[model samples]
Target: MNTKIEKLEHILTAFYQEKQIPAHLSAATVYSLMAGGKRIRPLLFLELLEGFDVELTPTHYLVAASLEMIHTGSLIHDDLPAMDNDDYRRGKLTNHKQFDEATAILAGDSLFFDPFYVLSNADLPVEKLVKLIQELSFASGSFGMVAGQVLDMDGEGETLSLAQIEQIHRLKTGRLLTFPFVASGIIADKSEIDLEKLREAGEAVGLAFQIRDDILDVTASFEEIGKTPGKDILEEKSTYVALLGLDGAKNQLTEKLSVAKKLLTELGITDRSDIFKMIKQLEVK
Candidate 1:
């Protein structure tokens, strides 16, 4: 895992250096890219590829990095004054705070848009590359994360049912999480039936992650979460904790993880221990 992470870091570092980016934009983009994160999405993609017995390559790393860029861009926008209005992220000044609001927006835009350019240049077949782009756009665009964000904002300060909260997360968080599995399946040339199972497993993992996050937001401190804690409570947003209480939410997390492990078993993935380790680490305490 450390080796894979180091490879990803090297790839991201070289991206800007190789490209013809303007000085300031490059700084802002690289700052957010290098910002500390768990790199969950990309790591899952890479690990899943390994599980599928596909040898790692620079192309795979670029695909993973592209996904990471989208995730980082979303975070930058999420911390904007119009959104969560956060000042810190991963123990560093939020993009808007580190560089002004306009620069932050442009930085996020760069992260979001440049991934396609990166993907286009990857050493892959045209059909596969097009399919990857299509899936990613569906996940990150209006049908997925963006729609989820809109629902989240609209539901703020309003009572929401558990099902509603789940719907929001399944799109917002679950879609991106599921993308790793689907993308991995595509790269591995797995059957459609297997791909569907991976998607389901990924969604379960996604929900488990969000539930743990809800728990941490209530229990963790600034240093612990590396972001503004209790933002959900502050914004009167719906969350698993708000709807389920601590015990109930933990129970849900456990159930979701069990489901994920079960699905992985059904998928017959050979090298799944890494993903299992990641799932275990999502535990709240």
Candidate 2:
């Protein structure tokens, strides 16, 4: 897993060096791109491809880079004053704070559009390339992450039901999380049945991630989480911890993770310890 993530970082670094953009815009974009992150989404994609016994190529790394690009763009926008209004992310000043609001917006915009360029350049067949583009677009755009962001903002300061909160996360967080599995299936040419199972496992992981985040927000410190803690409570946002209580939320997270691991077992993956290692990282400290 570390090897795969290191390869992804190398690919991303080479991409920014090779591509040309406006002077300040490129700097702002690269600032956040190079900002250290867990790179979970792309790592999940690459690891799933390996689980399917697919031989990875430079093209696969390109797709993983694209996924990271989209995820980073979302974080940039999410930290804007009008959005989460965050000052720090990944333990550094956010893009809007590091640069400026306008520059951050443009930087995010460029990252969002740049993925399509990277995906188009991947060595996959035209059909697979189109599917990859369509899946990414759907996951990152209004119907997916944007929709969740909108709902999350709207639900702020309101008492939301469990179902409402789940819906928001499934759109905002789950879609992108789910993309890696579906994309891996497309690249590996898996059957529709297996693809659906992978999608389920991905969704489970996504929800588990959010739940762990909610728990961490309440329980962790600035040094622990690398960002402001208690933001959810500060914003009066509905969370698993809010509705389910810390213990209940932890139980829910455990259940979701168990479901994901079980799905992988059902898929007949041998030596899934690497993916399991990734899943284990999501657990609360």
**lDDT values of the candidates?**
0.89, 0.89
Error of 2 at 251 (Å): 0.6
Sequence-dependent TM-score of model 2: 0.97
Error of 1 at 180 (Å): 0.7
Q: Which whole-number lDDT from 0 to 100 does residue 262 have in model 2?
A: 93
lDDT of 2: 0.89
- Show where candidate 2 strays beyond 4 Å: none
Residue 4's lDDT within candidate 2 is: 79
User: Residue-wise lDDT of candidate 2 within 1-285, one digit each (tens)?
Assistant: 778788888877667675555678878888998888899999888888888888889899999999999899999999999999999998999999999999999989988998899889999999999988999998898989999999999999999999999999999999999999899989989888998999999999989999999999999998877789999989999999999999999999999999999988787655743677899889874
Kindly list the per-residue Cα lDDT of model 1 for residues 97-117, writing each as its tens digit: 999999999989988998998
